[model samples]
Target: MDNPVGMDNKPIARTNFGSNFKIIPTNDQIKELQTVIRDRSTSRSDFVFNADRLIRLVVEEGLNSLPYGDMDIITPTGETYNGLKFLKGNCGVSIVRSGEAMEQGLRDCCRSIRIGKILIQSDEDTHEARVLYAKFPEDIADRKVLLMYPIMSTGNTVIKAIKVLKDHHVKESNIILLNLFCTPSAVSMVTKAFPLMIVHTTEVHPVAPNHFGQKYFGTD
Candidate 1:
């Protein structure tokens, strides 16, 4: 497969990870992100609102990749109908702080869905991500997991999170990454490390913002 052209007009690497790697095809999503990034005057509330909207789309795209089974149903007209039903037993696990931003979107998509959290921060000196904390459901091994992380820069944090999931017995093929933006390098690194995993995102950027979380949260 040919690499897709990103905003910088550079070729973004394509992954052999699986059929689940998806980029939401929506100009509106791009527009919203541009508004959030280019408008330095954008208030924190407004930025969060636009970001959440985009996150909802990413979450929906991720959920669509989950396993589904066809079933026969009866409609209001008492006619037999054929429909596809999502397989039950799915869960969301988010890398804390930035990743938590996508959790509400997941809940909106699937009410009462089980959610887990992992806190992984980068070491200031080494710049490597290390898991500080993790909390997951006991039956996580049996459920399909949607790993939420808003940005994929070096792919270090995400890789660590995936390792934690694997340690908890989550199957590699059953894990899907829901991200807002990802760099080509990050995408390649992640797919190469876990070829069976899926990655779903709104856009692919050539580079990540220097202080994405800080800027968005008005902490910078």
Candidate 2:
């Protein structure tokens, strides 16, 4: 918990938070599978597989940070082809426990990438987010950071975690939240707290699959 920045990244933004929110497009099949994860009758094996499949899309999009420009290459025909280049100084920081579940999908997207961890828990008395541990790349300030947490409920944990990053000199614009499902309240609170921050997710429902970590890790 070195240099924890108390709470919050900056003054809440007065602008609309919706513009900063990005949702992964879903079709009928994707929609049906999303429902599968929330069904209590689903078994652990099924739950883990389907959940992984769905979030894999989100993970890829967030990691790729898509639709690049400026780089061009030549094919065998000698014709120029425009393409995207993966930016250097990119790293991921996952909030421990539940957030750890999204780690593998991230690795799959970037094989040699470095990953960081931050462990935040709620104080029993104060009911506030408390950072117990944090570790990041030495040059994290220069790197684009992805906060890999699946679900956002009250958003207290995420707000606190972002503060920790800001303390270490990570710019709000350089940070992207990779989430699977979040409520409108969670989305609004987080986007307002750090307006420049970007959020990528699959769905924004009234209820998140909060049981995600428990079931994904087989704790249930």
| Error of model 1, residue 16, in angstroms | 6.8
Per-structure clash totals for the candidates = 0, 0
For this target, which candidate reaches the highest TM-score against the unseen true structure? 1
Q: Could you tell me every candidate's TM-score relative to the true structure?
A: 0.89, 0.86
Global fold similarity of model 2 (TM-score): 0.86
Candidate 1: tens digits of C-alpha lDDT, residues 3-62: 456776776656553565677775865666756854778777877777778888788888
All candidates: CA RMSD (Å): 2.4, 7.7
lDDT of 2 by residue, 1-220 (tens): 0110112423333235556677776678667777899899999999989988877788887865632447899999999998877857888899988888888888888888899999999876775999999999999999999898989977889999999999999999899999888776788789889988888877666677889989999998
CA lDDT of each candidate? 0.82, 0.82
Instruction: Give the C-alpha lDDT of model 1.
Output: 0.82
